[model samples]
Target: MRLPSKALIAILFATAALPAAAQDTAAVPQSATAAALECGDDFATWKQNLANEARTAGVGEKGLSALANATLDQKVLDRDRAQGVFSQTFTQFSERMISDYRLKHGAANLQKYGTYFAKGEQDYGVPGPVVAAFWALETDFGAVQGNFNSLNALVTLAHDCRRPDLFRPQIVPLMTLIDRNVLPADVKGAWAGEIGQTQILPSDYLARGVDGDGDGIVDLRNSPADVILTTARKIESRGWKRGEPWVQEIRVPAEMDWALTGRTNKLPLADWAKMGITNRDGSALQDNGLKAGVVLPMGRKGPAFLTYENYDVYLEWNQSATYTLTAAHLAARLAGQPAFDRGNPDAGLTGDAMKALQQKLHDKGYDVGGIDGILGTNTREAIRQEQMRLKLPVDGWPTDELLADL
Candidate 1:
């Protein structure tokens, strides 16, 4: 999740100030050659190159000045590289993100800003708890919006060769924000350059900003009303259906085919019911003429969920499975749902343990992919295959016992 610091800085300096005319010229060095240059070798050059890109992207003088003032922020780089969320299991991630403090504060914010949420729900047909869930998960109900300089962070990322393709295009919208004065030059936010109480990216803000506070300004950073309403608008624009459950924890029979359990593989409720799927409490699953996919983030040993169309809308906000699940589960909590029935808080294996397990599986001829210490689909599938080979319960969870046996 974090960029390689020395490599990123070297690339930023080496690519400095190459003119737009040089972009197509063979004389211009590639990102690889540029990344090998000395640190701060030609920072002015990089900034000027970025300025040219901004100009081409239609940014004006105010935007140019904002970019000019940006400094290479090592702290932003550190934060960008320290994203540990990917290493966390669903239980671990949920426990931390939907902490007791967050839940209590989120509920309070929902009440304190009841009228604003009510209006947002009414207008967008998005539920109040759903909006509140995003608010809470994003920045802990506005308690901890990160303090990194937005322009500097965005510029640094744009300059870095590690993910220039992804971060470079974001510079233009950020410049536009400065040009329009939607955000000040020194605005602070998450290291990836998301701003506001909801941690909206500059591009999303530009595309979906809404005035909810009746102050005639869509101030997402300061106005909870705007933040909530704009978030509602964003999810709606991203295809959030009115009156739909995002996801609900459910149980499937042991004999059910494991191949069908993923976000992309949808089946009708009737089919699932026929296979002995039930609600969390052993109740019958209602067939509502809707299709849902079974999602087992923690594999068979963990909880299962029937994810609906609105769940995909959550993906548009953040692509992480746990992130989307956290917000949706938080929404369920805010709406008085009970705790999930199947997750074990102690089931998470450490990163090193995961790597060891991956190595052991790899040695056994299982395609575990790269041993990055993150339990992606390939890793989980390998674990499942190993368990089946050993005649053990094929739950797909990497445990200390499993590692020891391997």
Candidate 2:
């Protein structure tokens, strides 16, 4: 898919910082003669200059030519719009991912690749199912890998304004891949530009891609072993602890210290036990030497968890807490645990309702800024503020029940 022109324009505005007047002048439609003059006069020259920068950054002559010849397709832009929002609720996202599909597939995969999992666990310390969970989340047990051109997407994103600095370094390696024939010219992937079964970037693929199946080529597209092993390696790179569980559901006492329930406010396991934290099944917090922090993602009324360092490792795979929780929960289910007991309470808010909730929070002396529907830091802080004000145990997440009350 081609990148969106508006996105491209945004990128240009971000990178070049073109003056407002110049932008207005450039935006006006022109006839063919005027367009050719405008191209030579301004926009074409600017693009040519960026092309020169690309070539200097190690894009080979042919690679640079390919990029120059390419145009950002509106279809790609439409795809970006379509792919903007996640459809599942935090509960549904968790349920479907941790459902029978993952469990059955994970069990079969564990059995089929028992040796690999065992070896990987022994060698890398990351659990077999954790690796399998990543596989399920990333590619759905190898069912549907993405189909965007990695080169174009990365190039577009790198050159695009929003995060050009973040993605800029990727361009050279991406071009290098094209030049070295590591990635084919026709490679397709996700809209954000990730590629192959596990959705890795070119640089990551270059650094850690391995021929896990003994077939010689490290192709994640068709090889389950390569995807699994490479994902395990990525986790290892992020400091996955050997023989440690990522997180476990816990039972917190009604009057427990809510202050100790977040990554930002961590206390030792012993300290948590002293405050009356126990496993959901009523087991005592025995001498598992690993330190952990409590997290009540859905506030005090929902399930509480004691998240270990390995949970952070899972977070490195996907930054979202919800995404990480889903992966970890799915991993647990695959290893034979029941689904989470507390249902999600924030599933009912429509987009507009979410914004209204934010506004209500701001009105109630909470600091949720202008009611953007995005549940970002401001919204979260507002949730915490309300929880503190109401004297409920504060977890920063907003729940539908809480919104309704507001």
Candidate 3:
């Protein structure tokens, strides 16, 4: 269930470097009104209003000029509207993300850039394997960073009201970058606006950028050192514990309380051991004197993990649990861990079918929240309760038979 690498767009800024002289060089085009005729009047008006705000925020003339020709990208809108359901097993995700190509390439990159990794580890307290995992997972070590024009993507998303709050704020920092000439107007990235090696958002780039190379400028797209170290710093800023494990796959006893499953229970390791949880190989669970929550990724059957505080740092990077798990698992593999067992199960339901199932469960008062088709915590819990009611396997996963029954 790797998160679809649909653009990870973001903005960046060099606020202090933006001078009035630099702003004056790029003039706002007089044809903005005519270009509005192409993207529609609403988009034109939105751009104008935002441009005014950018001016007040010190974006200066060059940034305003860049925005004057901004065009709407339908692909960005389409990608935003699209939502995903986690259906792939851990084996599937691992095979796709941790392919031999990635493993070999990632290891090679680790060696090639050993100095940066070492400095990153020393400065940010994040391991080289973890940073490499992120690099491999996000844009495949920068090989497949999307080619969409990041400015157009951000402007289009900001104009679209569906999620303006999230996309609009990013525009200013990007304009700041343009004003400072740190990024060219034609710079491209994923459709969603994420840029650079780690596919970082613009706000994050501005906040967490590090001069990993000796050069003063933090060039994320071109400098692998900056990219890796920036990522390490960003995770450390987001509360990555220095030496704590992110997650460990574990075996659970048949009689273990199903209620204790999920990512928020926060039971101590000893308490979980008392409840019959142990290492995946059925060895006694080690008492690390730390609290952990159980993550039943595919319910009680597929794969279970004891997620520690560091797991939350992965969530901070990507909200999707599946995506975080992929990064963590990749990190483990890079550290020489073997593949874990994966149980065979039927193919999961599609997004539409899952939406219908969520609607059905919600209608039956199972509290699936809204019918967006995403199998979030509410929907999974609803499925679990319904499974219990129907005397079926209470794994919280949906099946065709369960849909028919509903």
lDDT of 3 by residue, 1-406 (tens): 3433433311111111112112211233223232333343376666777787778777888889989978888976776665432444445545665677777888899999999999999998999999998887766787777777888987886666554444555677778777887788877876667778777666666667888887988788989989999989877977888878888888877666676677777888999999988898889998898889988766666677888889877766665566677778888878777665574445566568988998899889878757876666688878888877887767677889889888
Which lDDT values do the candidates have, in the order given?
0.72, 0.62, 0.72
Runs off by more than 4 Å, candidate 2 = 1-62, 79-88, 343-350, 359-378, 399-406
Best by TM-score: 3
Question: What is the TM-score (0 to 1) of candidate 3?
Answer: 0.84
- Of models 1 and 3, which has the larger TM-score? 3
List the lowest-lDDT window of 10 residues for candidate 2: 12-21
Measure candidate 3: CA RMSD.
7.3
Q: In order, how many clashes per candidate?
A: 5, 5, 9
**lDDT (0-100) at residue 24 of candidate 2?**
20
Candidate achieving higher TM-score, 2 or 3: 3
TM-score of every candidate: 0.82, 0.78, 0.84
Which is the winner by lDDT between candidate 2 and candidate 3?
3
lDDT of 2 by residue, 62-139 (tens): 666656654444444455444223323456446544656657777999999887777667767777888887676666
- Summarize candidate 1's per-residue lDDT along 158-193 as a digit string, tens digits: 566554544555567778888998888888876777
lDDT of model number 2: 0.62
